[model samples]
Target: MKKLRNNTALLMMTLPGLLLLIAFHYLPIGGILIAFKDFSYSGGTFLKNFENSPWVGLKNFEFFINTPDAYIITRNTILYNLVFIVLGTAVAVALAIALKELRNQRSAKVYQTFILLPYFLSWIAVSYLFFGFLSADKGLINNLIMEPLGFHPIEWYSVKAYWPYILIFANLWKYAGYNCIVYLATITGIDPDYYEAASLDGATKWQQIRHITIPSISTVITLLVLLGIGRMFFADFGLFYQVPLNSGAVFEVTNVIDTYVFRALMNSGDIGMSAAASTFQAFVGFILVLLSNFIVRKIDKEKAIF
Candidate 1:
């Protein structure tokens, strides 16, 4: 009781954010019932309609799980996320380390700003930017480079074989800069005395970095990787949809669970199926976080997120 009174101001400071969390996250959880319902708007209010809807238990799940495209969508979602997690971590850490080595502060800030600029761009804008380089007749790649080099212009959008690489590259380009900023902040917080001590002991730059820098940031890296594991079943909808201009030819490589659900929702207007898909995603994501945390705890309890 005494401690609670003493920390009253700090607890009060957290009240607004707590309320927002309840409003946005906790309150809406009741809508998960829609997953099992043949949901429709009949009259009164959303909650009332939700309540009155007839239950069709698990029928909605069949729309996604029993479809022929199920395997493809699931495979693409998992594979793309695995690649993103591995490559994104490597590139972000490498760039952060390289940026830290820059001697000139002004140039470093300028470079950081330029690198992070793409992160702020909407996927629609990035799609147009990509179109400038990929347009068959007038694109810079085709007209300037391919023609000058005596190669034929490729139909970039129609080629499913190339989209896997293209999407991976685009994902990295948009996100790596922002990801590196986190690592760079972690690196900056590291003590300079460790490096000085290593240098006095005749350690090279590489040795000092390997021994000090990476170890110091390992916790942040583990935390980020665990978070990424939780979202392994979700893809960035815009990256798969808008970036490819929604090309049907590249759907084999680009279509993911989110995109598949969106297209299904658009065509059929099946609210129950869409809700079911979302519920499934949330359940799988929750399980994944728990499993990953369990493994991490077994390997190194200190690094486990829980």
Candidate 2:
């Protein structure tokens, strides 16, 4: 009671966020029941309809588990996320280190601002920016580079082979700057005495970074990676849906579980099936976080988030 009284203002400051969390996250948890039911709006409030819905057991899960897309969407989601995690971390860390090494502080800040600007742009805007360069007929790539080189104008959207790379590049372009800023903050927080000590020992720049900087920030890196693994099942809906313009031909490559569930809901209006998919995603993500944390704890107890 004494400790609580001392931190009363701090506790009060957290009230709004705590209430929001309960309202948005905890209260809706009861709606997971809809996943197991043949949900229908008969009348009255959503709670009334939810109470009156018929139980359907695993029937709703068939949309994902028993369908042909069961493998493709799952495969795409996992693979894309794996690439994003590995490649994004590498790029972010590298950029952060490079930015930290810059002799000109003003130039570094300017570059950082430009890099992070794309991250603030909506995905809808990004799609149009991509279209400006990728449109088949009069796009800059087609008109200037392809035509000038005597090659045919490539139809970017119709081609599935190019999309994986395109999406990867787009994801990096949008997110790497924001993540770089995160890592830069971590790097900046590290004590300068470690670098000074390493320098006194005749360490090269690379050696100092390897032995001091990376080791110092390994906890932050692990935490971020673990948090990312927790969302492996959830793809960025706007990136997959808007970027490709929902081209049917490229669905084979871009169709993640999120987009697949969205399309299914749009075409069939099967709310129960959509709910089931979301529930499955959440459950799998939860299990992955636990499993990943266990592995991390085994390797290095200090690095584990829990």
Candidate 3:
């Protein structure tokens, strides 16, 4: 009875968060049914919208799957995310190790602050910044480098070939510092005794990091990679949309699932199709997470998220 009474206060403290989760997350789950129905906003009560909508079953999914651009969007989404996961993890881990090795605490903090600043900037702001550099007329690259080297200014916005590299670089610049903080924390928690023992055995700094530091953080790296895989189907809408300035010329390389859905919604005003696309993304993400966790469990039961 005493323990139950003591736990009652903690339960009461959690009630608000529980209510919020139900209201925001679980409540919208039923709306997923809208994907199956041909949803339309009728001029009537809110419930009437669903009631009057026609049931199209799997037609919406079939339509999306059969679309000509479906393969392109899916390929772009998966490939870009794969590149992001691999490059992001490598760069973040390297940055974390470098920061860990920095002997001057003040300089380390300054470097961290500068690197992390880009993560906080809005994508719209970054787009304009890119404009200053990539603009064909009076741009930094054209005026400072190209013109000086007797080369004509390239039309950056119209060129499809350059966007993939630009987008990857922008993603890394914005997110690497944020990701590094996680690895840095893990690195900081590592036992000092391992390094000391390695040093006593005449191991160099590179050898110690290879054997002790990286091994210690391998589980964290695995967990993070799995999480990245889970969301591989989703793309950052702003990064793909705003950064490219919605230029039609670059759509070949810049288009992804999210932007494709947005364009479809804008053109067709079909809420059902939009909902179906979202549901598809969610379902795929859920399956990937489960599959990744299963594989992780087989490899290392202790490190499996489940």
* Each model's lDDT: 0.94, 0.94, 0.94
Give the poorly placed runs of model 3, Cα more than 4 Å off. 1-24
* Model 2 deviation from the true structure expressed as Cα RMSD, one decimal place: 1.3
* TM-score for each predicted model, relative to the true structure: 0.94, 0.96, 0.94
> Candidate 2: deviation at residue 210, Å?
0.8
Given candidate 1, what's the lDDT at residue 296?
94
lDDT tens per residue, model 3, 244-304: 9999999999999999999999999888888899899989999999999999999899788
lDDT for model 3: 0.94
* Per-residue lDDT of model 2, residues 1-306, tens digit only: 999999999999999999999999899898788899999766768878887888999999875688899999999999999999999999999999999999999999999999999999999999999999999997899999999999999999999999999999999999999999889999999999988988998999999889988898899899999999999999999899999999999999999999999999899888999999999999999999999999999999999999
**How does model 1 score by TM-score?**
0.94
Clashes of 2: 0
Flag regions of model 2 displaced more than 4 Å.
42-44
At residue 274, what lDDT does model 2 achieve?
Answer: 91
